[model samples]
Target: MSNASTSPFPLAACAEMLWRDRPIEWRASRLKELGFGVGLWNWPEHDIGKLEATGASFTIMNGYLTGRLTDDEGADELIRTARETAQIGKRLGVQRLNLHGTGLGDRGLPVQPIQVVTGVMWLKARDTLSRIVELAEQEDVTFTLENLNLPVDHPGTPFGRAEDTLALVSSIDHPRLRLNLDLYHAQIGEGNLVELCRKSLPWIGEIQVADVPGRFEPGTGEVNWNGIARALKAMGYSGPIGMEAWASGDSEEALEAFRAAFTI
Candidate 1:
């Protein structure tokens, strides 16, 4: 746990990004030594028991939803998959699972403005997500909807804007459904980081960080880390902010810079 006197949010190490050459257990042990309160993991194959034994909290496994919710069968499949994921969360003693919204058209072109309009897809997705949120509530887990900025990272992802993602969460009106505000993607897709953080504070379950221009540590890119950290602190956002960036040099050096920048 982080000292409340300093940073409001604790820093979490992304297992999929740092020290990846070693086994998951080794990585978890290292994070424990480094005082990381949580580890952001994506795959299901990891040894959850080993990770837990190391004393570093881990996020629930994440994966892309295969079918579109617009069709009956697809919606059914999406709900069933969410139920299964919730079951996995319960089994692992993890409380939060992150998920991505619909991907946009093919990569390599300017994001068409029409992509933002959810249209019928919103109704279908909302209905499907409602049932999924119910399952998540029953399992005592949260599903965080991450906003992936399309033009930079996703290229053609539909739910790239913070407004659309916030609207989805608001429309769902479920306690178990929340947003995962990834600052890196948000900065690339939209420059107003602090305002978005303030507006989405109520529903934000997790926050991930990396610098823009390149997914590197805070000082390596153009993002104003000092300002962003101050804003998060001011808003009383206490969730763990994950370090999801790639290390530009020595890993320890990168971490030190992050700590110094965030003043955590």
Candidate 2:
């Protein structure tokens, strides 16, 4: 990373910490009480103002890109959800929304046939994306396409790689549609994190972080923050950095673990 200075990194919480294995409610006030910033996903619409009063801004919360594509009638549901989230976030003063680009499935060993079908699926997925972008744009929130990590335990997904993510962004060519890079997902799905971030500096809109091996904290695992952090700094990113990790313990303990990890 050839940068003269490193930008300040903001610590934020993602939905999994609050809603993965437990209730997602009460996350905002808990964060406010604990003095944390950077909203991840599933923000409480009921008390968004109070959450904002805690001096935290939303980085990127979940969106309905995929949810809108599920059923024929789901389109309306997606629009309504996005509109509501945007209104709630706007009232809370958040600027970004992160969405899972598309779905993934199993592939064979050769993977040739699978790639072809997946490519077609990804192309079809553009229709869903178009709807999402239009809604997000109208709502005044930046929509970022999050790259899938392939589940490793599952199968192949259509939009898992950086190349695929960029391809979708290029295809859509919408100002609201941009890159939402996840370090843990990239570590699991792509190669050479620093190199990839360098190559993709221009496309990245927001960065969500968690360490590798177990998606824990910085020093709690094998992820090399020294290089990635330097590369992010070198790329001149000044957006909110989020914690999109799972809580191995209770919420407070998990928050403590994350805070401890940031100290590294």
Candidate 3:
């Protein structure tokens, strides 16, 4: 629902991640009660301004990475919506635009060489990212690419690893395209957390935190929160740490576990 933030402080999300039908204004007020604005994902158009009205800070912007961007027209629409969202985020003073780096079309493509030179199917991926960066720059909203692995990522999935996502940042070479590193996913996708964070450095915009097993709170699952926190400290990462994981029980229990594990 939220980001795996180092602060151990709960960030905002829709219906606190339950996905139940609720008003954005209501959600924003609830998020304020919890102390911060959430990365708004499944929100309506009218709520965009309303969520910002609640004084909750924006963390992530969705609407582009779902089953929607499977075709060319959808891709253009995705970019257009993304550009508009970036403008909204800028007006709302949100710092990051979190996005999924790949789509379904990314799944079936085969990697091959051209003219004795092996190259990735970077054309489609590269083009989308370029447009995202250009539009984000217009709004001054820096981008954050979250590492989504497991079953979804295929050979052609745009970016599944921290380095790959970071490489996109390098290839696009845009200051806006950032790595939204999720520690839990890293353990599954790429385990060298220290090195990944070290390599990404300034380009690493946001971080999500959670343990393995059930992907519950840090303590409930299996990540070394203390060590990870130390690594984050070593990297001099000062951005918001999101508690992005499943809850075992109620909100209180979830937050308590989150604090116990993350408040290093």
Clashes of 2: 2
User: Against the true structure, what is each candidate's TM-score?
Assistant: 0.86, 0.72, 0.76
* lDDT, residue 117, candidate 1: 41
State the C-alpha lDDT per candidate: 0.69, 0.62, 0.61
* Cα error, candidate 2, residue 254 (Å): 6.6
Give the per-residue lDDT digits (tens) of candidate 1, residues 1-264.
242345566777676667657887887677666666454544456766666677666653452234333446766765666667666566556557776654233442322333554477778767867876877767778887778777766755555577768888878867798888888888888879999999898898888889887788889988889888887887787777777878888776676677767774
Q: Lowest-scoring 10 consecutive residues by lDDT in candidate 3?
A: 109-118
What is the RMSD of candidate 2? 6.2
Q: Residue-wise lDDT of candidate 2 within 1-264, one digit each (tens)?
A: 201123355566764466454333356546655655556555543355555565554566765422433333544555666677677667667767766533221331112213333444665567767887888767777877777576552244446666677777767888888888777788887868877777666777877777777776555578867566666766776655667776655766776666554432
lDDT of candidate 3 over 190-254, digit per residue (tens): 77777777887777767776677666666776567767776777667767666666666665466
Ranking by TM-score: 1, 3, 2
**How close is each model in CA RMSD to the real structure?**
3.6, 6.2, 5.5
Pick by lDDT: which candidate is best?
A: 1
Clashes per candidate (backbone, < 3 Å): 1, 2, 10
Report how far off residue 222 is in candidate 2 (Å): 1.4
